[model samples]
Target: MQGKRVVVTGGTTGIGRAIVRSLASQGARVVTLGRDENALKDALDAMADLPGEVHGIAADLATREGVERLFAEADVRLGGVDALVSNAALGAEPIDEMADDDWRYVVEVNLVAAMAATRAALARLGKGGQIVIVGSISAEIHAPGESVYSATKAGLQGFAETLRKEVEERGLRVALVEPGTTGSDMQEASDDEQREEIAKARMLRAEDVAEAVDFILSRPPRVDVVTLRLEPRLQELP
Candidate 1:
């Protein structure tokens, strides 16, 4: 893990932040990207004492322009990235209720942004480089009303599968880590029924997902842990 350079999108908060901290603690140089300037600053400040190098960049990831700016800065500062944890996603409204503006924003942020970031990182990633997409179980099973979010996550799952084949020859590894009910802010926007279902889980935490990432990345250079679907369930698979 010494001196590995990692890029984590959505790193100002939630699972993304946890991934940044874990990587930084493992002696990996980490660059965390988010749009919130204040939150980015807080993320940087919090990571200052880490043993590895830590930096933060604020860029709106929902647009092509924003992704371009992010990678340009990253090139100037990091030479190239060895790992990318693409976690930036917009969880949005029900299909019938979605405004056109909101629908566009959600798809652009949740799917396209991650693709652009992946393209940038893969451009320079050498052998042993890794990509982890922080996906959702929503990709596998859609709920009643989360059409936009579910569609984007399902798209991510498809993208990851194709990506693994495209990059494997170059020794680049890709994995989509789909987690069910992570203990994060995604549910704060949920209505009572949704929130109640999430609360019942013995739900997965951000760090739990981070550890799954750690496990994947820690594999030997020849090992690739692909398509991880982790859910916290002792009660039923029954």
Candidate 2:
């Protein structure tokens, strides 16, 4: 990434932050987006020594308006985007006991927001661009009580497949990277014993997913890893 321009949404903390650091270290001009003002400032302060330029845009990624604003701002700040990582998403809310408000928020952020960003990114991203939609293993399994979340990821999988074909003519590549139970904000939301149990088993590190993104971006233009399912060694379904 000597001069590559990269954009990572939801990049203030957790997996998103890791991706920002990884790309910045490789000399990519990284622009991060998220709603956390303090966290983003803190992240940027901490990465003061990275090789590439680092910038942040604080915005609500749960709406189309915010996404459009982000892309427009990115155009002024970075000129054009060479790679995009759509990693921000609302977690799965248990469907049986889900609140109506939570359901709407879930769909807006997880599904609609991603769609909006992808649409905008396509316009700003030039030829030879790489788009990676971070997905989950839950997209494949019928996890009890995570209907909306699972469905959204499943939908992303399909969307990536379609986008890949549609944009191939312009040398654009789109792919899906699905990881199982990554070490992220979601892991911290659980208790120690529960986290340990999951970690000791097969939870992936967010850096690992970031590494996958790095690999996808580094590939030759003619080749694209269309889909990847990243699961840890200790994970086994009952």
Candidate 3:
């Protein structure tokens, strides 16, 4: 990944932070986008000692303007992006109880922003460039109370497939990663006892997913790991 210019969204925490660290350690020039300024600073500080370079930009992906700002920042920070990771997303409550505003917010971040970013990245990416959509296993599991999240991820999967086909002719690669039950802040949102039990079981670590992203980015131009599913052995099915 030496000198590779990459952009990662929602990269201030959790799985996204791990990916930024891993790639930067291996000589990639990574630019991370997040909505929180403090978290962005923390992410950069955490990676200060890494071998490669990392830069952060604060942008809320829920709006088209924010997505545009992210790419604009990438242009100035990295010159041109060789790869993009659409990792920003928000989970939603059950459809029946979800407010209209909340539903729109989730879709805007998870689906609309992802598509918009991909389009913008394509304009800068040349042959051999790659795009990885950080999706979720919820798309397959379809657990109750997560209908909106599941729908977004499932839609993202379909989007990736069509995108791969359209961009293959340009030598641009597209891949999707589906991670199950990662040990992130999301887990902390649950009750303390439930969170403790899940942690004790050694749920999939953020680093685990980061390693997968690293592998995908390191592959040869001709190779594309279209869909990679990462799940902890101890994680139960929904």
**Per-model TM-score on C-alpha atoms:** 0.91, 0.93, 0.94
> Model 3 scores what on Cα lDDT?
0.89
- The models' CA-based lDDT, in order, is 0.84, 0.83, 0.89
Better of 2 and 3 by TM-score: 3
What's the lDDT for candidate 1? 0.84
Error of 1 at 169 (Å): 1.3
Q: What is the lDDT of candidate 2?
A: 0.83
The candidate maximizing TM-score is 3
Which 10 consecutive residues of model 1 have the lowest summed lDDT?
Answer: 189-198
Q: Which stretches of candidate 1 lie over 4 Å from their true place?
A: 189-201, 234-238
Pitting candidate 2 against candidate 3, the one with the higher lDDT is 3
The positional error of residue 18 in candidate 2, measured at the CA in angstroms, is 0.9
List model 1 lDDT by residue over 1-238, tens digit each: 7788888899888888888899889998887788889889988899999998888778889878787777776677677888888998877889779889989888999999999999988887988899999888888778767889999999999999999999999989998899887766565634555445556764676788899988887889878888888887732231
| Residue pair clashes in candidate 3 | none
Ranked by lDDT, the better of candidates 1 and 2 is: 1
